[model samples]
Target: MVLLSLVASHSDIDLETVAKISADASQVASVVLASASPVAGAITLATCNRYEIYCEVPQSEDVPAARSEVITQIAASTGLSEETISTALISKTETDVIEHLFSVGAGLDSAVIGEREIAGQVRRALNEAQASGTATGSLVRLFQAASRTAKDVGSRTTLGSRGLSVVSVALELATDLSNDADWSTKDIVIFGTGAYAGATMALLRERGAHNVSVYSASGRADAFVASRGGTALDESTLEAALSHADIIIGCSGSDHRLMSSDITSLDRAERPLVAIDLALTHDFDPELGALAGVDLITLESVRMAAPEEQAQSLREARSIVLDAAETFATEQRERAADAAIVALRRHTQQVLESEVEKVRAQHGCTAAAEEVEFAMRRMMRQLLHVPTVRARELAAQGRAGEYIEALETLYGLAVDAPVAPSMKNAAGCPVTGTQSAAAHHDAPMQSPALRQVG
Candidate 1:
């Protein structure tokens, strides 16, 4: 199996930098169908932070050539100039490929500091990529390990702590810079009280913001707000309430901008309105930031203000991924051994049965010594079944090497004309079935990923 990756840094890259030409699934599928892109399983992962394409291609020629074809397909779908898209991404190799994906899953590589939403984004991206016939073998294993590593990383971190949200960080940033420090004097309006919004509110309350008012689309949420000792306002009334609101925090998932229409929207604000937009897709409009009286801070504005660490968790996570990949390599080798033995048993048995039949044909006498000899050989073969069947089972599960090694030593089965079998491995040799390590090595290494951590 072959593995590769496409990565784009935030500087020159646009999410559309990797966005497929097909806005929807059916359109992309049509393109794949037309290209005769020998992809058996495909997956397209697109997000604001990064865009990636992975696929499982059938045996044709080289994997490197196949990699080039996949990137070309992605470029065609996106309508980006070939050079532009190609520049945005770089291929990952060896442990680099596996670890990078794990970082993404772990949310260490998100725009927002420790944003948990990235996990879901990665999952959705993998699902789409798989649908495109771009996922199989190593790519499939890579994603599964990435996802597992991500889960472990998240569980271990203080990521889920209330103080870890972008919203909390935004409020703190705003509070530090803003001269109007009185929580009771400043009217703060919170729009959309989802997890992000909720976390923001908790932070605001911790800052002793007594005059906090929360608004959500659901009317029933007012009681939930009331229980928290904050005034509940209908989200429908947010436009009118903006005049009284000194600071506005928005965490809505709407594609359309909620506030600001030209300079007039901010002209109504009595003070410098601090509007914080904290969505991956940017819930607020960019034009609003240009408004005279509006002090709009969005994901783009703070896109530069990421978690201060160069992702130490990411660095540590890479180490974990490397270790996992190494463990996997060992398992793959052991599996190859099992496969060699199981094939030898099947091949030897076939020759023995055929040769025995031929010898029986030559002896016309029914009760000849040759017939008795044939019967004993047949019984020996039958007796060997006990060990052969066990060895095959172990080989199928990736442990056939020990059994095969023992049998070879016991029976001394040898091919006079010796050549290294065509088994795929670190050496890049292709081995034939039964003669090679297909059942043994491939089977043991066949699992999507070995769970090294919870």
Candidate 2:
């Protein structure tokens, strides 16, 4: 199966479009699973700012046709027109796909470059695909390599050092706004109780904000607040909290706006209301920022204000990502070469065994015959060593497909190379060369614009 990728990320698309596409990750996964032919398997990774479908298609299928089908499915799920999706999507094949995955895992593709959350997201996508039995061996290996690369980058570089993330950036803005006043005296109200909410709560506490209230749009406020040591407010009290609060943090994960025209119009405190909306869908009405006593910081603004790494550091991190991707591709090629080497060895051993048995039958099973059998085995082993090593070397050198074809032609061995299969399918019958060999080099992917929220 050949690797293909379809991507819609914040870098190339607007937030509105991205939100629509990412509304349901599961539905996107379903579309990918159903539309592709002989889908060796597929993984759909949907996050706040990106929605990508990675598919493994049998080489026999029309690649362009399959890509069209997947784009059609995405349009169906996201209510987007096919023309729009076709125009907006970023497509990658073969090694380009590998490089993109590695970059994403390393957080080099994220809007907040070096953000650590994408590594977990990539892992979760792989896990979910595996659970559904859609992930094949190639994908498993690719994603594992990605995860390892990300961790390596984190350990080897300062990419993840210094509190970095949308949350941290928002908090920095909050602290800046609260500079004139003591953080301990401010009444902070946070919307939503998901991971973002928890993270915000923790950071707020670290800044000495003792008076905290949480509103759960999903009705988990009680549990969320209890765990985080904050008072849980119900919908009825939302307006009151909004009016009196010194600070408002939005991460409700709700599609509906938290601050409507009526809520923001209410009069009161002299201290300006500092609103930080970290959610992708935008938790508050953007118009609320126009009010006289409110300072609103949003994902876009935070992303704009995000710190940029020194050029040298960025170059180093990118070098790490590229190196990891090359290593993974080489490993996969080596693995693909293994099948032929194994088959050749097995055929040689069988021939030697048959010859040894014939000699024993002809001469009597004597000590001399045994010695002859041992000699024959040793000679065969020595004869096969050079070719076996060369085949592996060729595979590592990106000539795997050529060597495999040569082995098949020379030995008259019908080679069926296996695609990445779960352990259950590891011993699947040999496949012939009808399918095209894996590509040695992928097209260079265009450098996506500065990382966006995805």
Candidate 3:
């Protein structure tokens, strides 16, 4: 199987393009299912800075054609021109896809390097795909491994030691000029009741900023405040909240400006109000920065101020990710080899049992016939044990594909035959099978391994 991906992230694509090219997770599933043929399963990861689609396809399929089909589907779903979609995406397959996923899960590819949130995002994406019945088999395993790799990076290295996040950076900037005593006296007004708002509030509470209020552009402010323990403010009280707030956070996900001319009109002491806009689209107007007692920080500024990882830490993080990817690939190869090993063992057993039965019938079930049967069984086991062990060793050494191919050529194993749900992993690798163990003598065997072994 080929692991194929189409990625649009902050690394290459601009924010506007990423937003335009992005598809809903369910929409991505629909597009994968709409492919012509040979598509196994798919998973979509759509976050603030990225929109990625990971799919499993037959290795023999024409890669260029499959990619074009995927691109066409994305264009149709996103209402973007095919050229635009093609330009916005970076395609990866096979080992490259594995490496990219590991890096992403570890936050190496994020705008804020080594951020802790991406690991959860990757896991959540996988869970969502599984829940929607979009991810299966090898695809599931690939994502699960990626999540594990991220965890390893976090726990085993200092890559994630800073716990850097956009919200965290914003908070740092807000408190950079204030002392611990100032935090106790500070009043913070958060404008947005969404995920970013919640994160900001949590960070503020963690930093001992207790006098915080919530302002909603929509009507859900009261409920949000109720859940998170903050006072909700409406339009009538918004000005008052702003007047009292020393720090204002805007993450309302609105295209329109939340800070109007009223911000300038509000009565205030000489204290400067720091406004941090976390929205992808500007929630605060540029003019707000020009106010006499206001300092406005945009998303771009926050990203710039994000903490950088040391070179050694970055190298360690990448090393960890690559190692995890290699381990996952190795395990997959071993599992592939296991299917063939099981098939070969089963074939040998069936042959021994058949020959023993023939001998018994010919010899009229004598004690000598039973001795011959036992001898033949022992001989077969001895003859097959070395080859089975060698096959598994080859798999662990990254030569499993060649071994599998040789096994199929030598024994005519039908490795492409449909397997039961329980037998297949997310990548379409067969885990276990025994139903057709004794049926190999038939022509054109349809078992997952050994189409024919005579």
Candidate 4:
């Protein structure tokens, strides 16, 4: 079966709606399982930013047609325009499949640069696919190799060192407040445990601000309490702390301002209050800014702040990813060649026997008949030897996807070679794969963006 991958990322698609569309994990898994012909393996990797379907299918079925069916399901689930999904769906043939999977495992295709989270996500996804018994033989091996490479790359390098995702211009603007103004010995309290909050916390720490407390209405108190370095102060406690804090980082989801002085009973203090609201809605009470010694920073004002420059170290990390992508593509081509050569040898053997038998029948059973057959076999092997060698050698080259495709075509071996089954099929259905969803319970993914809340 050939590996097919569809990429849907960076388009102007509704992200939350896409998540909702992909929420029916069972249906998505079933479709993926059903799509792969001869049941090699199937997996659907999705997040708010991207959704992809990978499958092993026989060369016969129309690939684009199968992918379109998946697109319909995705659109139906998410309520997105079907045309958009169709337009965005991407497909790769032969070694491109392996290259894509490796790139994904390596986080080259991730929304966040050098995102460490994608590795665990991919591992869990492969584990599910394998458990469903849909993932068998070569598919299982390919995925394992990809996962191993990811682990190796991550462990060896400082690839995701920042861990801090550089988001929209808003958070960077908030960062400027620390540099533009000096708030030493200031109580910089974080309200809401969102991604923005975490960023503010890290920045606050960088600025030598002590008493950095994090408060959230929806956030877990236990997590906050154990946040050790970060105080897990609740909204009630947050308001009380606000009076004494020099910088108040607001990250709650309340429709109304939770920063009102009346709520906190802020006694007019000599210290200046810099309240940075990072929530979608205004979290801090507007009146709090009206109080003496208070400066309220809203999202609009945050957006107005200058953008942060890319760090040199992070840029270097990006180079590492690019190098890894090239290396992965090279490895894929070599393996594809190897598979093609195996297919070629089988086809050649069939042709050789047929031609030799025809010659023997036409010439009649004479001593010369056996000699002619031997010479014919030798000649055929010699004629085909160079092509076979070239096919394998070409496969080992770096970034040789196009070459691999050409070699497969030239050798008359279809790129989508059916993999032999190592284990018997558990499902009775005519499957390219088994129709099973990820049956195991994995911990729900916490929004990396949520870590930004303050």
Instruction: Give per-residue CA lDDT, model 2, range 1-454, as digits (tens).
Output: 5788888887888876776666544555444554434455678887656888887766635468767877777778667788987887788987899999999888888778888878888998988776655666687788889899999888888886775776887778777876754788888889888767887898888878898998887788899977788889987987787778888888875865765575546666555788898877788888868877778888777778888866776788889989988888777667767777776777787789899989999988889998998899899999999988888789889787787677657776655665444212233322221211221123243221221121
Candidate 1's error at 257, in angstroms? 4.5
Candidate 1: worst-modelled 10 consecutive residues by lDDT: 445-454
Model 1 residue-pair collision total: 27
Candidate 4 or 3, higher lDDT? 3
Error of 1 at 268 (Å): 2.6
Total backbone clashes of candidate 3, pairs 3 or more residues apart or in separate chains: 13
RMSD of 3: 6.2
* Candidate 4: segments with Cα more than 4 A from true spot: 11-27, 34-49, 52-55, 60-62, 87-164, 167-171, 177-221, 224-229, 233-327, 333-391, 394-416, 420-454
The lDDT of model 3 is: 0.76
Estimate the TM-score of every prediction: 0.58, 0.85, 0.81, 0.50
Best model per lDDT: 3
- lDDT by residue (1-454, candidate 4, tens digit) is 4566776543434443344445453355455444433434556776435566676555436576657667777777656677866766676655677767776776555545555556766776677666555554556666776777676656666665555332323334444544544445567677666544655566666656667777667756448546647677765676667667666666654444564655346664566656776554456765766766566776445334523325663455445545654665556556656555555556677788998889888987888888988998898789779867777567665323454466455654453442434223345342323322222123242211101111
lDDT of 1 at 104: 65
lDDT of 1: 0.56
lDDT of each: 0.56, 0.75, 0.76, 0.57
For each of the candidates, the C-alpha root-mean-square deviation to the true structure, in angstroms, is 11.2, 9.2, 6.2, 11.9
Relative to the unseen true structure, what is the C-alpha lDDT of residue 120 in candidate 2, on a scale of 0 to 100? Answer: 82
